[model samples]
Target chain A: MPDRSVAGPLTDPGPSHPCGGTSPRTGEPDGRPATAPGCNGRVTAPPDDCLARNEWICGAYLSSRRDILWGAVLQHLQLTAVSVLIGLVIAVPLALAARRWRWAAGPVLGVTTILYTVPSLAMFSLLLPVYGLSASLVVAGLVLYSLTLLVRNILAGLRAVPEETRQAARGMGYGPVRLLVAVELPLALPAAMAGLRIATVSAVSLVTIGAIVGYGGLGNLIYSGMNTYFKAQVLTASVLCVVIAVAADLLLLLAQRLLTPWTRRQS
Target chain B: MNILSEAWSWLTTSAHWYGQDGIWTRLAQHLVLTVVCLLISCLIALPVALVLGHLGKGGALAVNISNIGRAVPTFAVLVLLLLTPIGRFGEGPTVVALVLFAVPPLLTNAYVGMREVDQDVVRAARGMGMTGRQMLFQVEVPLALPLIMTGVRIAAVQLVATATIAALAGGGGLGRIITAGFNLASTAQVVAGAVLVAAFALIVEGLFELAQRLAPGRVRGGNTG
Candidate 1:
C-alpha cells in the first residue's frame, strides 16, 4: 500500500524547482514539493530536458493547454461515466425487486439514506482501509453515492405507472419480466432520467474531492492552486469546473429532450 | 479488546479538540458560521421573494434565476470564489459561497408560497381597504407560512451538509475533524465527524418538523379547511 504518511497536504507547490524559492504571486513554492510538475502549476517540462526546465511553458499553448484541458475533461468524464453506469446496473434491479416484493423498499431505502448522509470526504476516508489509494476505491465510493439518487428516481418512476396500465398488461397474459421490459420500463424512463440527472450533477461535484486521495481530476487543479496559493490556476480550475458543470447540465437537458420526447411536447 | 481500548483512548483525545477550552475553544465558532450563513441568505432572499410575490411582476425571471442557482454546485462555487478578491480573505469567501448556495431554495419557496395564497383571501383583504403591505403581512404571509417553513427546512439541511466543505476553505467546523481524520488515516475520527454531521442534520430536520407541527392552525390547515 502507498504510504499514507507521505501523502502531502492538499495544498502544495506545483512543478517549479525547489531552488526557485517562493513564487511571486503564490507564497508557496513554485510547484508543490511533493507533487510532480504539471500536477499543480501551468509549468510544463520540456521533452529533452524535463528535469532542467523551470519556466512555466515548455511548449506552445495548443500542446500544453490541450493536454491539460483534455486531461481534466477525460478524468471528469471517466469518473462520472463509471459511477453512473455502475449505479444504474445496481439500482435498476434493486428498484425492480423493491417493486416486486414491496418489503425490499424499506431496507433498500434505509441503506441508501444512510450512505447519502455520509459526507463524501468521510466516505472516501472510510474506504481507504479496505481499498487503499486506488481508482477502484474512488469509483466504488462514487457508485455507492450515486445509488441513492438513482434508486429513488427509478422507484418513483415505477410507482407512478397507472394501476390500469398494469392490469391491462396482466390481462394480456404478460409475465412480470415481460411487463417490466415493455411497459413499466418505458413509463419509468422519465423519472429514472430525472434521477440520473441528479446523480450526474452530484457525481460531477463530488469527483473533485477524489483529488484528496491523489485520484487526479479537475479538482486537482483547485486543490493544487490552494496548496501553492496560485490564485490564477485556482481561478482557472474553478471557472473551468463551473463551465464544465453548466455544459454537463445542458447536455443532460438535451439528452432528456431527446430521450423523452413526450416530456418535450408537454412543455 | 485492543480495538475497544484504542477507540476509548481516541475518544478521550477527541474531547481535547471539542468543547470550550479545547482545540478551537467552544462550538460557537461552528455555530456562528452556520447561523450567519443561514441568516444572511434568508435576509436577502426573503425580501426579494416578498416583493416579487406581492408585485407579481418579474416572477418568471426571479424563478429562472433560482433554477440556475440550483444547478450551481456549492462546492464548485466555494472553490471558484477562492480565486476572487473576496476569497483571499479566507472565511469571507466561504460565507459568500454558502449564501449563494442557500438563496435559491429560500427565494423560490418563499415566492411560490406567497403566490399560492388563496386568491379570495387576498382580494378580501384588499377590499377591506388593507394596504398591499398590510395584505402581505396580515393575509399572504400567514397563509404562506407552512410552505415558507418547508423551504427553510430544506435550506437548513443543505446548509448543514455544505458547511462541511467550509473546512476545506479554512472555515472551521466539524469538517476540520473529518479532513484531519482523512489526512491521518484515522477511520474513527472520520466516522465521529460524519456521525456528528448526520446527527446534526437529523436534529435540524426534527426541529423543523416541530416547527411545522406548531405552525398557526390557519396556515397549517388553511388549504384543507
Candidate 2:
C-alpha cells in the first residue's frame, strides 16, 4: 500500500489537484513546472517547497488543495445528507408500520439490526451488485445502515405517547392521520431527533469509506494522501471530517431543542 | 443468481482455504487484531470508568469526552496514524486506531452502568459493614453487570467490524480478501470476502450475546441462587 500510495497520485495526472496547476484564487501560473521528477521516478511537488519537504502541517498544502478540498467536503456533505434524509423517510413508515401492526415490529427491527451489523466495507460490497460502482451505492448502503437507529428511536418515541393523549385527540374528532401528525409526532420529536443526530454524525464518518469505490468524498482525499504519505493533506482532510461531524450533531441538537421546547423545561 | 453461485463456488473451493492469503489465515488475523485491540481498550477504559463511576465524580467529563470521540471517523484516525511516525511499525497504526475506536463505547457504557446502580443499594451497602472495595467488587459491580455487559458487547462487535481497516493500512485481516478481490475486479471473490467478514461479525455478535446470557447469575445481577 505504501509503495502504491507513492505511485498512485502520480498516475492520475488529471490536474484535479491545483498544486500542479495555476492557483484557482490568483489565476496566475505557478512559475515552477506542474510536476517535478520525484524520488524513484514518482511525480512530486517542485523542489524546496513544503511538499518537497513532506511536512505534516504545511499551510501551502491547504492553499494549493483548496478547490479539491472544497469539492470533497461538498461531496461528503451531499452523501451524508441525502442518505440520512432518505433513511428518515423510509424509517417513518417502518416505525409506523411496526407500531400499527404487531407482527411487523419484530421483522423490521430484526432486518435493520442485521443490516447494522454487516460492517461498512461489507455493506458497500453487498450493495455493489445492486448499485454498481456509483455514488448511489454509498447512499444506499448508508440508508440501510441508518435504518436500525432511526426505526428503533422512532418506534420508541411513538410508543412513549400516552394512550390518554391518543384518546383525547380522537375524542376531539381528529382523524388517525391528524392524531399521528399533530399529537403523536410532536411528542416523538425529541427521540426521533436524537436518532437523527446519531444517524447524521455516523453517516458523516462512514462517507469516507466510499473512497474505495471513488465516491468517498473526503475519504478519497484521505485514502490517496495516505497512499502518497501526504501528511498535510491527510491531517487537514481528517480534521475537516471531524469538524463536519461535530457541526452536524450540534445543528441537530439545536433543532431538537427548538422543536421540543418542552423537553428543555424538564431535567 | 450468477454472482451468488460464483461466490458459493469460491467459498467451497478448498484452494481458497489454504495458503498465505487464505480465508483461514485472514480470519485468524482479523480475530487476533480484534481480540488484542479489545484487551487493550478494556484495560484502559474499564478501570477509569469503574473508578469514576464509583466515586460519582468526573463521570460527566468522561461521558462527554467519549461522545466527542464517537464523532471522529475511524478511517481518518487510521490514515492519520499511518502518515505519522507510528506508520512505520508493523500493524502499530492499525492497533492504535482500533484501540482508540473501541474505548469510547466501553468507557461510556461501563461508566453509565456504574452510575446507574440504584443509589439505595449503595446506601444500604454503606449502612452495612462492607468496605468501599467490597461494595465495588461485590454489590455495586453485580448491580451494574447488565449495562456493563451491554457496553462490552457493543465494543466487541464494533471492533470486529472496524478491524477491517487494517487491510487498507497494509496490515493483515479478512479485509485483504475484499481489497484483493476488489483490485482484481472479481465480483465473486468480493462477494465471497464480504460474506466471510459479515458472517464472522455476526458470529462474534452472537457469541457475545451467548456469553452475556451464560454468565454467572451473580454477574447478571440479583438472580443468584
Single-chain TM-score of chain A, each candidate: 0.78, 0.84
Tell me the whole-model lDDT of each prediction, alpha carbons only: 0.70, 0.83
lDDT of 2 by residue, A1-267 (tens): 332221112211222233444222211244557685555667876545565456667787777778888999999999999999999999999999999999999999999998898989888887777787899999999999899999999999999999999999999999999999999999988889989988998899999888878888888888777665677677888999999999999999988888888988895
Q: After superposition, how far is residue B63 of candidate 2 from its true place, in Å?
A: 1.8
DockQ score for candidate 2 = 0.57
Question: lDDT at A182 for candidate 1?
Answer: 89
Query: Per-candidate TM vs. native?
Result: 0.81, 0.91
Give one digit per residue, the lDDT tens place, for model 1 in B1-225: 343344346656856566643445324555677788899989998888888998887678667665576455565566566655686575777788878877888888888888888799889999999998899898888888777777777777677767776666555666676666666776666555555555665677778778777776765644535
Residue ranges of candidate 1 with Cα displaced over 4 Å: A1-24, A27-65, B1-8, B18-26, B65-67, B88-90, B127-129, B213-223
Interface RMSD of 2: 2.5
Query: Candidate 2 — which residues are off by over 4 angstroms?
Result: A1-47, B216-218, B221-225
Q: What is the Å distance of residue A125 in model 2 from its true position?
A: 0.9
